[model samples]
Target: MMSKEDKIYLELEDREFPFSYTDHDRKIVRAIVFDEEKKFYFVRIHRDDSFGKATLIETSGGGVEKGEDLETAIQRELKEELGAEVEILQEIGIVSDYYNHVHRHNINHYFLCKVRSFGEKNLMPYEIRDFHMESLKLSYEEAIREYEKCSNTKLGRLIAQREVPVLEEVKKMLLIN
Candidate 1:
């Protein structure tokens, strides 16, 4: 279980925390876009508000605009973040919790997305300083190893378990021999 301090840190890191208690609550969406070649995973490098430093985060998503469905939010975020369109494969999971001193509540929707092609990456002014599609392929074990290096946050754990249908689907899509 996460301590109150840890939960607060996470909410601040995600920028979901409001300055005042009366601020309107909002939903945020993010995508995990992977290429079939297994060469690169799209990610953003940004300064975490809570951690006070820049870090590479393996997610592409943003706030859910008013009256928008989750899928629409995901698509809009992908285009806004990466300048690329994608076909969402499935909803991997959801993480919901409260961050004391930060957000009253937060629910992050995770999705596995397939990109048609790698295009120019466009970073949103706030969430990203720069972005890239790097060549890093990992087996299930390797993925877990990498995830272990980071704090055991929900996102980290999810990335550790990313070897499931996502990897399998990628292998099938690329026809890796």
Candidate 2:
């Protein structure tokens, strides 16, 4: 059980699928980013890996580096992954889930942000070859449909369980739904 006090909560949220991981802990960040036009950005990835090419769409951001604050890590991740400069307007709390297949646990912090500007994306090496990604700005209805499409696959189900609620929460907060 996670409360507001613990910096690193060693627990998991009740999930649709039981989540567990080999690694004890990791911290990550993601942003629900909106541009001036009101469309949100989601990364559509074609993952070429041992399992073959699998398509997935996910909100952007990544692991928090040691010694980095949450705000800085998120900013850096957005710049790298989305080529985006953003002003984070609000914190959307956290989500905890396990990747049983990989034996890893993720403590995902989410935020709601407004895009300030666009720059060139700086994806990491593997992100280029293994996960060739394209950022797509979609309307809320389109995002919901994409989530449903993603949930049809095994891995996609897990991602949807972890991320869709964050999207839903933000949608409600913004009164767009």
Clash number for each model: 0, 3
Looking at model 2, residue 138 earns an lDDT score of 96
In model 1, which residue pairs have backbone atoms overlapping below 3 Å?
none
Where does the lowest 10-residue lDDT sum fall in candidate 1? Answer: 5-14
Candidate 2 per-residue lDDT over residues 1-111, each given as its tens digit: 344653222344434344453666779998999977679998988875543346788999899999999999999999999999999997777888777655677889888
Which consecutive 10 residues in model 2 have the weakest lDDT in total?
6-15
Candidate 1 wrong stretches, greater than 4 Å: 1-25, 38-40, 48-50, 128-143, 152-177
Clashes of 2: 3
Best by TM-score: 2
